[model samples]
Target: MPKIQKRKIIIAKLIVILILLTIFAFSCDSKKPSSRGIRISETKTYEASLYRQNCAVCHGAEAYGKEVDGKQVPSLRFGEIEKKTDQEIYEQIAFGKNLMPSFKGQLTDEDIWRLVRFIRRDLQGKQQ
Candidate 1:
């Protein structure tokens, strides 16, 4: 076929492959808890507002976890996140891990630290 047609076909295949990979990558076990504690909208704290803007999408507004189309996004409030150190949480926010995107450039160090505190203090109800 023509070069233009061949290029289009290649692009289409690549797009399909990317989509499939994304779906597979994000897919999680269905047995995990669907929803539990607080709803994101209920919390009125500044930290909660920040979380609503940045993390509520994947983690759900309440941090109780979220599942979309069989894909399970882990909850900050329920998982081993509580076991993690403040530094660990801070690093995860600064530098993304697995499917979580990094917020290095998007948020300042202070903001990221605040988020860490928000998760620990506000969401988890643990004093630092």
Candidate 2:
């Protein structure tokens, strides 16, 4: 083959490889693990947003808890949160206690459940 033709063939092969690589990259599942190290599902995504809007104020952005006044606000990071079952946590969120306010009317059952999952799986890193 002529020098020009060889150069053209090499360039074409390079272009083909680039195209295949781009397709593979795009085709690969984009569902990445979140900053919390949990794989974010649709429900989890919504739950995370809810947590930020509703719960983050007292719970801290990472659900690690914050101190208010002279008292330490309870953290959802670990310990007690991990010990509680899904239903128990749901009740706490729905009914409220002490400083925490009830979310009974504000959040639906599904939203609460997703919140529980997010707290357990994402914040606490507990396996469901």
Candidate 3:
């Protein structure tokens, strides 16, 4: 093969390799866990939005429940939530209790699960 033709082929191979490497890097990054241990692609943005819109009023924006009258509304943070199992939390979210409303028809199972995850992992900082 001519020297110039060989050089061109080598350059084309290098370009292909570089492109593949770039794609591999990005693909790996997409699977990386965020500081909260959730995948970068699986961020709690949607769940957080759901919490803000649905539960934040009673639970407070930070998952710390607000008081009504002279009673404490209860906080979803660490110590307060540590008493309940994930299943219990799921049931509560699905069924509702007292002033809290049921999210069964409004939110899907997956959405509720995501909220549970956000509350447990992100808000309460529980390790899985």
Which of the numbered candidates is closest to the native, going by highest TM-score? 1
Question: Which pairs clash in model 2?
Answer: none
lDDT of 1 by residue, 1-128 (tens): 99999999999999999999988776764544434434557667777787988898988866877995578888798588988999999999899997788999888898899999988876777767
> Between 2 and 3, whose TM-score is larger?
2
What TM-score does structure 3 among the candidates reach?
0.61
Q: Best-fitting candidate, measured by lDDT?
A: 1
State TM-scores per candidate: 0.65, 0.63, 0.61
Per residue, candidate 2 scores C-alpha lDDT tens digits across 10-113 of 99999999999988986785664444534333434777898888887787766667887766777787657767888999999999987778999999988988
By summed lDDT, which 10 consecutive residues of candidate 1 come out lowest? 29-38
In model 1, what is the error at residue 26, expressed in angstroms?
36
Q: List the residue pairs that clash in candidate 1.
A: 40-61, 40-62
**lDDT of each candidate versus the true structure:** 0.81, 0.79, 0.77
**Tens digits of lDDT, candidate 3, 31-72:** 554344333223458877888877877776666678866667
Instruction: Show where candidate 1 strays beyond 4 Å.
Output: 1-39, 68-70
> Which candidate order results from sorting by lDDT in descending order?
1, 2, 3
State the number of backbone clashes in model 3.
Answer: 0
